[model samples]
Target: MIKNANIGVVLVTFNRLEKLKKTLESYAEQTLYPQYIIVVNNASNDGTTDFLAEWENEASPYKRIVINLSHNLGGSGGYYAGEKEAIKLSASWIMVADDDAYPSADYIEGMDSFIQSYIGGRLAAVCGSVVEKGSYALWHRRFKRKGFSLEYSEVTRPEDYQKKDFEVSYISYVGPVMNKVALQEVGLVDKDFFIWNDDIEHMQRLGKYGKMFCVPRYELHHDVDSQNSALSWKSYYGLRNNLVLLKRYFPLRFLIVLSLLTAKAILCPLKGKCLQEMRLRLTAIKDGLVGNLGIHPVYKPGWSLKKSV
Candidate 1:
């Protein structure tokens, strides 16, 4: 609806080629198309690179910029790179999404409408309602901050969210449309985070500038499992990054969180895969405390340095 609005869409992906394809199709179906679609491929070995190459070569209505990294930078690094590029393109607003997440047909249109109407330099960012599977996924919620320790509360009743836009203290990477000026002031995402909690840190930065809102009219479908099992590589990054954030924000609370994680690691089952997970958790705690970041060699997705019994 808004003419010549440079809305850049940045999508970060790794190994999820099928989901990425569906996401791209969703983008194509948008009522209001973005000026640029920037896809940051994190060196996925699962034919993702080949697929992107073909997609980029194909004819499209809008411009497609694909950046294939030599190594996997994880979500944090990937988003940093993509958003930086979006800023360089002189995008007035930037929208970010994961490969497994996509917006509804009028998603971008609604975001632009809000930007043109309600956002008169008062709002830093705006996110849409995220629906996973068939039900309302309360991935976007308010985060209560206490001495740098962050906790979020979900809406028990999804029907409570009316058509009106609500203020949010926290914003995730899923389908958030960010203003360029706010991004320039806050700077890019912390690539050092490597994975989890980067969005929270970015949300904190944006909160310094202006208020962020969640417009329920714009919907996005996120294909993600809300639960994480006990044994997972994600445990390492989540625990480590959470500790890093705690230490950076509140040093006193850091020790308290560290002690709890240490106890969990020690009390974990001592045999089989649980033992492996325990070892990884302990390593994460150490890394978080010492400010050791970047992708862990031993603890990674799909592959890990498993110890023998």
Candidate 2:
């Protein structure tokens, strides 16, 4: 372990007890253990509480700090709470990851190594490369762009990242090790975001303070297998928060994003599930345009929009 690293790893989870268990197991394999493992339970109704209770008791290398909230705070809120706790703990570095994100044994070691070697002033964070299944996840290592445009097509091959670290525009929640100084300057994750694009918004702010880079040398396994084609409650969060981010960071590009969303909303009916998809998209557009965020009572996981609308 790097001497006086004072690293704190924060994980946000909700209703994924088994996956979280695997994540914790992965942490046990880490060569460079952090000072603390902060797991924020977003009020999961599953056996997460009991599992965490037992797991924390039998901890080995690091102190496990578990924050059990009374209600589901979503990923953004969970990170906000967990990171706040980490900041209070006076950790020099704070690493945030999803419950399903399993970092490689040498992940933290690589990050600290890079940070130590980096001559760049005011380093914001280092985003670790993420792998889905056996392939490198290109989407996780996104290109930072000015305005509302996003680019991940810069590097076609994952092998290209093997040789050198690249500065990133976007910061995914997969595995980004942040400096506490940057966190203190940027403040905590926006609880208003509740979920999607919260990282994007936070990334925009972090850029102002310091440089952010992606070090593919450090890897993490993201076990998510969710289908992108499916439009669910999360689509609402994605759409609305994206709009909010566009307006906040790229005011000039706001109308362009709005236009694209409108076009998508209009053409979404072509794919069938006409009314359901259209209504959902339109509702998202309306809420986004009006800047109405937070959990929508009508739009929730496993809950259909057809019933309410």
Candidate 3:
């Protein structure tokens, strides 16, 4: 509806070609089409690159480009790569999505309308509501603090969301559209994060420029499982990165918080006998405190790391 709104989308994915295909289909089905779509593939070995090459050969309506990464640099690095491509494309506003988020037909229209709103001028980033495709449940989680530690217990809805926009401290990397102006002022995402806490750090930067909002009226189908996989090992990065963030940004509170978390790492597992909260978790805490980062080569037995495309 808005003329000459060159909305460029940056999609980051790895090893989820089927999900990526569905997302591409969903993007193609949008009522308001993007000017271009820049996909950042983090060296997927699942025929993802070949599949996208095939997509390019099809009679696709919108312009599409793919940036094939050399390594599995995780989501943050993937997003950083996409942001660079978006800037080069001279996008008016950049929309970001993970492979699993499937935007509705009016997704871009809603984003455009949100950007055209009165407070839109100050909105650094805007995100849409996401519902779990299988459970039909709200996707974001409600977090609470229990003195130096945090807990994720309840479902989070936009409490102040009337029929439209509402404030949010954080939003999942499901479907976030950011104003290029704000991005120019705030700068790009932290690639050092490599995955978790990258969005949080990026949002924290945006706060210095303007606020982030969620327009809960617009919805998307997010079909990923809510809980962590039983054999998953991503917790290493998640835990290490957040602790590293706290140490870097919250210097004065870091030691006390770290001490508390270290105690929790030792004492909590003893109480629950959880293997996930094992000695390896303490190793992560140590790794975070010492500032060691990047793709961890240490994987469990039975798993292999395909480092590149």
lDDT of 3 by residue, 7-98 (tens): 78999988988899999999888888888888998988999999988776677656789899998778888998999878877768899888
lDDT of 1 by residue, 49-142 (tens): 9999999988876789999999999999999999989998866999998999889999988888888788355688888888888767775656
Worst 10 residues of 3 by lDDT: 300-309
Q: TM-score each candidate.
A: 0.90, 0.91, 0.84
Decoy 1 TM-score against native: 0.90
Q: Higher-lDDT candidate among 1 and 3? A: 1
Runs in model 1 lying further than 4 Å from the true structure = 1-4, 119-121, 145-148, 152-160, 225-228, 269-275, 304-309
lDDT of each: 0.82, 0.82, 0.73
What are the RMSD figures for all models against the true structure?
2.7, 2.5, 4.5
Give candidate 3's error at residue 268 in angstroms.
Answer: 7.2
RMSD in Å for model 1: 2.7
lDDT computed for candidate 2 = 0.82
